[model samples]
Target chain A: MVDSVIQTKDLTKKYGEFVAVDGLNLEVQAGEVFGLLGPNGAGKTTTILMILGLTEPTAGSVRVLGLDPARQPLSVKSRVGYLPDQVGFYDELTARENLTYIARLNGIPDSQIDRRVDEALARVGLEKVAYKRAGTFSRGMRQRLGLADVLVKQPQLIIMDEPTSGLDPEASHEFLEMILDLKKEGITILLSSHLLYQVQAVCDRVGLFSQGKMVLEGTVENLAQRVLGGAYRVLVDVESVQPEIAQALEKIPGVAHVQVTDTKKYQVEAAHDIRPEAAQAVISAGGRLLGLGVQAQSLDDIYTAYFQGGSI
Target chain B: MTEAMAQKPAMPDERAVAALREREGSPWTGIWSVILKEMADHLSSTRIFILEVLILLAALGTVYVASQNIQQTTAEDQFLYLRLFTTAQQPLPAFVGLLAFFIPLVAIALVFDAINGEFSRRTMSRILAQPIYRDALLMGKFLAALFTLALVCTAIWLLIFGLGILRLGVAPGGEEVGRGLLFLVATIFYGGIWLALGLVFSVVFRQSATAALASIAVWLFFTVFWGMIAGVAAQTLSPIRIGLPDEFLAQANMELALSRFSPNTLYAETMVALLRPEIRSLGILLPTQLEGAILGAPLPLSQSLLLVWPQMTGLVAASILLFALGYVLFQRQEIRA
Candidate 1:
């Protein structure tokens, strides 16, 4: 029942001989955080620009919120907010003035402008600094102000290009929390970043981009299973080694593979949590289980393995 | 719950759907917002404040000296008000002459960084993301700069007139006032040409300093060397062979035409025709052609305007051409930054 907020069909953008965004089909459903994970020069920003109708694609098409971005750009832009990388503001204007300018550009009624700007600023924890010149604020403060700028538009969807790229760890964490808060209000968020761990922390689904193309996409856990066979690595140590124990562990319903790392230790892989089943199987196979634990794989490990394996 | 939700078609909110179905407004929407914002920036910037002060001082000094000299030398002249603008007192040029120099500087200062400054500040993409067309942004900046130029020129014009009336104890004739207003309009469009030129460079160059330097370089070439270049070009194109009268006239006409290509020449010509109406022709006048002419008799305001119609149109056309060039360059530019 989820509506597709953004749907692109074979969208491609080229600058002379160099292709910036290859023919790509991307779909983002309503109310979910979709992360576009890619290294620099991987065409994430180009894709965002095309979706916002800021740049024309060389071929194919884009639809955002049921409107063709190229044909109905005003409609698309008014409803979808974009926070560009290293978002900038007028150094001379105060934070309130900056947000007020954006609100007016969005055609918010004069009577509602003050209310909307104040509400957005307060939402980003920037109300205290609202009267200060943006140039005087710290980098992290500017990013928050950028989020406030987007919120003033009351957008149905928000697109951010590397929103957390240049922030301290605490600031980035705070920004992600604000994004999660927006998600709680049923606002669909599409953010691009090369920081895998951050994306994994916030995105419900993610697409891996390489050289202007989406090489793989899905939930982080699903991608982990697809690439690593199984991400749940359960390590088992038994007092006695038995061939029957390995066979029994492999019989678990969700188990994908098993390997003997030592004379008395076994590494069991499963699509999902099967640690209890693994323990039962090891004991029933006439092996005395001494220790058992699981090592959860992270998105960084998944991304590294995915690229190092040259799966593209 | 999931099965039930999957089977049923979710109906979109009626009001929300209707809002989306409403026809989008004209591409010019929010253009005023942009213009107001830019105009505020131009009027408040320290650079403009200094330029305004420089212009004011120049106006006060020139008009004061010109009025004092006019009182001493031409107290009985019928066009004493017009004299305030054109009479040069030693070591200082007339107000109109000063305008010929300062107009372009003020215009260039207003707009040399209009577009590229947005990129350098990293605000271009964010602003373009608003629910407005690129046309609005470009046109809005142009009109704002034009308006700013007009405001400054009008203020100086009024100041000169006020000083003229106060010092000379005489009111300007209706025709004199009308001519003065036309002079002000010409001054604005003269500035408009440079504003548009600066905009073109701003669009072409990503660095504000480069755009500023390029605009000033073009202005310097036109102001300092264009007249000489026009003469040399006319000599090459239409040589005055054997010293025939017709050939001399042809070379003169060709040179005038070539010089008019520079906005400085056009603006200067327009100012002469408007401020000093006694002049019968802007080109070589044969004795035979002036057989019945009354020397030194100022023509009616309408005839003077007719004489400078081409020059005035040339100023406007140059501004429009440059603005169109900037618009095309900006529309093609990528907003990635």
Candidate 2:
């Protein structure tokens, strides 16, 4: 069995009368990239803070790397690297100096600090600009430097909060690719982001958060199956749609629902890939099949479906 | 015997479990790193560099004028070396007066944004996420600022002494040096109160500008308006209704007590007793109480220190109290924003 690197049981946090995180039970297995998906102010950052022991939980317990964070913060913190949202560094210090300072704070030996900083910066693709001051870095570059800062400690578990927020599309793609590389190295990662589609490429599993609660948790595909009532969304464009075509597509085995989305396009939600059967139904109803393909279930559909009062 | 043998292994297991439950590592683990980093920042900052130059110019100008004045007048005084700090030339205050006015500014500048700057720059969470406890960060900033103030004060002291020896052509007495060293300590503590005040405001206010303004406002209050307010308060509290000696004494003591609430007043009293050894008491003394006392004889170094011990303690206590307040505030603040 894989080890659970992070485990929280009924973890909760409250600020005055407002409950920021309410009785959250979360677990992330080793070597898997877990995304905490939520809109802004959904208590994702609060949960991360409790796990890192930066803020005390109002109730419940959290263990990171098999150590209680509140009791063994130093040990947990040394092992679990965290990149806060809008992460910042000493702007006056060069990238190397910034990483070196964090390395020192983590108690990395002086003999290995330079090498570690160089390796971390190289890993983040920041070696060319290592001598430049952090203040001059762009938003994407600063995010990468934040990643380099985390990598300097060589942590067993890395937690990032809104790591890709406010980045251009290309930079966010490159950053997610880097995360996938870290996952290949068998490092457990937990990242939070409101941009669900951006995290979809790297996250192996995700927990959807709403109003300080984990509304749903599983693989994206699994969530799609559970929430959308199907694992596949097939779109069929017919040259001409007859009144019986919609009924014929619904009659196909494994097809769950059929909706006439436009003049000649039909959206078919199904339990499985019924693309072949769907094409046959369109053609047999005296209509020509123009195109038929399986639409990959993006997390956005599942998120909107879940929050739009759709049946779970 | 078998039961005891079985329990022996369990004892070590329980001990291991207890060890695991306890928090790992010392809170001071990265304190030295924080202190070194902050000290480097203070030493290299342009703001502090400018302040250092301003203070150096003030020290040189005041000490030069003072040494010249001492040479012309009071050349026969035995404690002419000590007079370098207290002697005021026309249109210029004494060196101690300058210190009392400028030390707070330097101290405030050093720490006005110490904590909030971290938040504004968004580095507080990242640094707090390190292995060290918050105690190390706050204390490191405080000690770094205090040490920087000490370094500046000591440099100015040595410069004044050098200037005194060069102009007066006489070495300072052993007693003068001791009193001077005590005065240096008092000066640092006086700066410490302002440093701690800046730190507290930094913890309280998120904007560095607001913290700086708040600290300077408190300093201005103490330096300018505290004495007048104390006079009015004491007159109202202990009015001289009958115009008796006792009423006068009561009002004087009351005024002194109220003025001591400000660090400026406490610092001023401390400087007077430490620099002028002939001072017998800081409080009002009836003539009948001093009838047979030797008029111009200087008290021993220890007695002068004893005379101002309360004032010195007041400065130290205020610094500690303000620092503790900041520590508590910083500890309670949520690291998230």
Candidate 3:
């Protein structure tokens, strides 16, 4: 059983009458990449801020590494790194200088600061441009510098808000690779993003948030199964298949529907495995079966299923 | 196994280890980081550097012109460079008096948007996110600005002193140097009051432009126009009058009192008290002998400081009070930019 590194009990945040986060309950296991998936204005950033103790919640409690964030924010913050959506830095300083300054702020020993800054810059693939002032850096380079800033402290948990929101495909890929490398070092991460593919690629588990509430939470596989109702698709090819072949496949156990696509192919859907029976039926019906395959569910399908025509 | 377990000591938990690491780190390191970073940015900004240099040149030029004009008119050459060394023996107050009136404006210009400009750049949230407390952040910025102001002002004061020694062909007396040192402290406090006021306005106003405008407005009202209006109002408001000229003098005193409401005025008045040993009031006093008979033969340096103590304390305290207010506001603001 994995232990919880970050846990919140009924965490809420309100801006006057508007509830930004309401009764948010979350448990992220140690060493796991947890994704907070939500649309715009869904309170993901607010939730992350509260967990980092940067913002006071309206009510409820938050614990990181089993310590109350509100009562011991420095303790929690010391072990957790955060990147706001909009990264702000001193434009007059070079990337290396920025990282070195942040390292000093994090209280790294003066003797070790240079090594840590170099290591962080290397990890973010920014060592080549480390001496360039951040004001002259591109958007992608700035994002990398931000990642380096967080990495310099080597926190136990890293929380990122829309880390790849503005990056192009190549930049996003590079950023994801960096995150994956961090994961290999046994650092737990809490990432909030609207990109489903990125979350599906990286997150060990994800929570779907909507309008200040966690509507669903589970592993990617589990969410896909739960939202898509455990449905499986089987595609078969046949030679000289009859309309009766389609009816025969449906009559078999567990199969839901069979649609004939062409003279020698049919699309089969079932709530469970009906491949064995469907194969037997096709052969017994004097149709020569050529191929059979199951269709894997995609995160896009699950995302649409949860968000379509549903209220949080 | 059970006996071995009982004999072995318990190790610290992960949470305890993390807490130890945090406690081992000094929080003030973050405050120093912010100060260093802000000072670096301020020094590198071309606009502020150019402004500082221009203001310094203007101050030097004004003192030079005033000295030369004094010498040309007096025909004795006694007043040449005398305005720079001391206000003594000169019919008019020294150029330092003009500096006292003008330096606060330059200082205020430098710092009026110090805090609000950071907010405009959206850098406050990032800086605040570090481990530093809000009070440390505000205090660090204030101190850094004050340090910069002091450095610039000191350089200008030295330049003026050097020019005076060159022109007069005589070294200044120890008392003159003592008075000059006292003037420097008074000038810093004067600039400090304006700096603090600017920071308070910076905190109160969200926009840098608004903060700058508000600071300039306060500067003008106190330095240039508020005393005139207050004089007129005091004349109309007062029920009794001694005589025409005396009433005007009374009105002027009332205006001076009212102008003290501005830190700029308080600074100028305090500096006058410290720099000019002969100056008795904002108004001209009777010749020193008659004045000495009324008070004493000669007032001690300590007594003169005591006379201006309220004004000095008021300016210093107001600066501190404004800073405290800014600190509280900064602490209460959400770190979200």
Candidate 3: TM of chain A? Answer: 0.88
lDDT, candidates in the order shown: 0.92, 0.91, 0.76
Q: Which model scores highest in lDDT?
A: 1
**Arranged by DockQ, best first:** 2, 1, 3
Say which prediction, candidate 1 or candidate 2, comes out ahead on lDDT.
Answer: 1
Q: Candidate 2 — what's its lDDT?
A: 0.91
lDDT of 1 by residue, B276-313 (tens): 98987888788999999999999999999999999999
Residue B163 in model 1: lDDT: 93
- Write model 3 residue lDDT over B1-337, tens digit each, in one string: 9977865554435554565465333435467766776677666777568867776766566666665655544444322433553443345445566566667666666677777776765666555555555566787788877777777778877888787666555666555566667667777877887888888888888887888888888877777887777767676775346567666566666766666777767776777666655555654454653543645233456766877888878877887887787778766777666
Q: Which stretches of candidate 3 lie over 4 Å from their true place?
A: A231-293, B1-29, B66-82, B85-109, B116-122, B232-253, B283-300
Count of clashing pairs, candidate 3? 0
lDDT of 2 at B35: 81
TM-score, one value per model: 0.92, 0.95, 0.84
User: How do the residues A163-230 of candidate 1 rate in per-residue lDDT, one tens digit apiece?
Assistant: 99889999999999999999999999999999999999999999999899999999998898888888
lDDT of 2 by residue, B1-337 (tens): 9999989999957865796567677767888788888888899899999999988888888888888888876656867867888989888888888889889999999999999999999998898887889998999999999999999899989988988888888889899999999999999999999999999999999999999999999998998999999999999999999899899999999999999999998999999999988899999998998999998789999999999999999999999999999999999998987
Cα miss at B152, model 2 (Å)?
1.2
Task: Give the alpha carbon lDDT tens digit for every residue of A1-312 in model 2.
Answer: 239999998998999999999999999999999999988899999999999999999988887888878878898889988999999989888999888888988999999999999999999999999999999999999999999999999999999999998999999999999999999999999999989888788999999998899989999999989988899999999877678899899899888888888566899999999998888888888788889978988999999989896446
Q: How accurate locally is residue A240 in candidate 1, as Cα lDDT from 0 to 100?
A: 76
Best by DockQ: 2
